[model samples]
Target: MQQNKNDLQTTNKTKDSERIPAIRMFNLEDESSAFEIGSIPILMPTDATSFWASNKTEDWEQKMHPAPRKQYVVTIKGKLKFTVSDGSTFILEPGIILLAEDTIGEGHSWEIIDGNEWIRLYIPLSADADDHFIAENIG
Candidate 1:
């Protein structure tokens, strides 16, 4: 019985380690922003102050700028191509979560890759909340 319990515990631990689809834009040591192909936990409880949705300008192409604050960006419509300071790029869509933490330095930019309009939600996290981001096993 104890052996079975231990096996179950190990299985649960493995399940918890599985990550969901996510992308992280973070400030690097040189004070420039970069992109990481990573994931947040399967279920992360975040403390957020508020959330708001927006449809950005017609241009739909942003120049380099940092995020206003640490937040989660959920794209509900339109596909986007995000480029960081290092010229690394990633495509994002409705099913992926954007962990925007590059609040300083030259951050990142994005352009609409699919439709004309890009609509998204910004959820600003509390100052002490955990982001639960993990960068590993992207290959």
Candidate 2:
């Protein structure tokens, strides 16, 4: 018996998954905080429900603050320098995804970088599925 090329290819096949960058926020009883990660919110459509876009000139200086809602941010253009409460900083460029959820106390600060224009998408979380993320370790 001879082995076909398809058989050989199938035997060597590999499974690949998509992992997006994210900045997770937590609303503690006393204060709010944020963290950065390279992976987040399983690649499913149930949790992420709504989305909006922000396209504007990147010339504003935002102080430490929390996100207005629990959502995901997907960068489409330009860059942003984010600094968390832990004194950590991250530079986000195009194709980076950030999950912003710290809607409680002290959040994070960010400033536009690299260019004068920035575009991104804001995806809100589903109320029911939001709890799932709250209890799970996504990092």
Candidate 3:
């Protein structure tokens, strides 16, 4: 019975480890950018230029465009379907963490879906720092 219990524990651990979400990072250098899965724990905010929360509902079939700056876009409620310039598409649901790095050239576009209102928090990345380094260090 003890051996069976140990086996079950191991199986559960394996399943949990496999369930990590792949974060999508829109990159300026490579529109063919791939998703990054890092080991970073939830980080406490250190320094930020500014942050804001808004509830919006837009008719969002926007053309492919880069973000004005590097930022962290968290979907607090509602969902959006995002298609990066490289042809990768992801559904941005509530609780999704999007590291928006495609600040130049063709970036990404989105269509608002799900609900009449979407709430989000936006935090711009530091001018002196880059997303990859921050992600690596935090993890």
Candidate 4:
């Protein structure tokens, strides 16, 4: 049987906390974009402006571009492979959230890996707000 998205995410979370898997793409001091593999609280509350949803992506999405703003990309369908400036990559799917904060550099790009449409929610974070991305492997 196919495991539920929540079940799959639980297998990758901290033992003491239930967090959804997440990856943050951000700008380094040199203005190059990088990513951290991590997770965020399952139900954390934060400030956000009007949100939007989309199932279609433009050709530019496959090319490198900075995020328009700090926001959360909540994917409800489709699997995508995102590549950062250093050529490193990660996969995003259900149960995984992407916090895109590299709004000023060669941020990242992605392409659909699964045949399903890229249905998603974009929640723009409030200015100067904390995104609460936990870099799980940080020392």
Candidate 5:
């Protein structure tokens, strides 16, 4: 049997890295549109529901739930400003990624900074049915 070099490299990197494994089953760039932006599911845990959030900002504002799962946001264009309940604000720029664990407390809101584009990937605490199965229907 023949093995590909890139595959071997990826395997080696996975084994060497101490961080969470990277799953690239979905692409955000394909979902962009001029109006009515939307999101898609990328990597879903076996016992949880995971999906992506993509939208365009044009002086639009909204409040968001803390969510029962973890969240990872990556800005593709413009800027995004998040104001937490504690009165601290966070700004996300292009090519930057932000991760919010499920353990974090609630009270968070988001807004577009000067009509920017925002894309977010959500990972649930439990696994999805396709990813894996929990014992005794715990999920």
Candidate 6:
């Protein structure tokens, strides 16, 4: 009986190890002029979840949905310029991270200054039972 229980625990650990890691990337469709262009993953957790290492770059301009949960933006690469709805701008560089509350309003904007390359990990405020956490929290 003890051996059977040990086997069951090992099996559960293997199953947990098989769980997917939530890391994603966005790519530009065309290599034309600097325009509002980037890719967003289709599968994003809603509640307080966490992302490992992710990267994004945009030559033009773009907006990020205010996080449904508080967010930590960690920059792993080039410069990223952020503009909030209140007409405030922040420039972030590599090895820098910022924390902000998920608030409602006009939202925030991003632009790549001097060619932007940023790696970030997003930790959501709730558990990700499903992707529905994002919908339930943001919407």
Best by TM-score: 4
Segments of candidate 3 deviating more than 4 angstroms: 1-22, 28-40, 57-61, 130-139
CA lDDT, candidate 5, residue 106: 46
For residues 1-139, write the lDDT of model 6, one tens digit per residue: 2568889999978754543222111112331111121122334444554566667445333765443444545566767676655455667665444444434444456776866355666554443233321111222
Candidate 1 whole-model C-alpha lDDT, 0 to 1: 0.86
In model 6, which runs have C-alpha deviations exceeding 4 angstroms?
Answer: 1-49, 57-61, 125-139
TM-score for each model:
0.81, 0.69, 0.66, 0.85, 0.42, 0.46
Per-residue CA lDDT of candidate 4, range 54-125, in tens?
998798988999999999999999999999999999999988999999999788889889985899999999
1-139, model 3: which lDDT tens digit per residue? 2569889999978754544332546564455433443422344443468889978544442677777777777788887877876787878776556777667667778777887667889888787654442233253
Q: Cα deviation of 61 in candidate 6 (Å)?
A: 8.6
Which run of 10 residues does model 5 get worst, by summed lDDT?
31-40
- lDDT of all predictions, in order shown? 0.86, 0.67, 0.64, 0.88, 0.44, 0.46
The lDDT of model 6 is: 0.46
The segments of candidate 5 whose C-alpha lies over 4 angstroms from its true place after superposition are 1-53, 56-61, 102-105, 123-139
Structural RMSD, model 2: 5.8
Q: What local lDDT does model 6 show for residue 51?
A: 66
Cα deviation of 49, candidate 3, in Å = 3.1
C-alpha positional error of residue 90 in candidate 3 after TM-score superposition, expressed in Å: 0.7
What is candidate 6's TM-score against the reference? 0.46
RMSD for all candidates, in order, please. Answer: 4.0, 5.8, 5.7, 7.0, 13.0, 14.2
Top candidate, metric lDDT:
4
Model 4 RMSD in Å is: 7.0
Better of 1 and 5 by TM-score: 1
lDDT of 2 by residue, 23-103 (tens): 565656667575645454355554675688988533333787877887777888888888877777878887556777777
State each candidate's clash count.
0, 0, 0, 0, 11, 7
**Which runs in model 2 stand beyond 4 Å of their true positions?**
1-16, 41-43, 57-61, 130-139
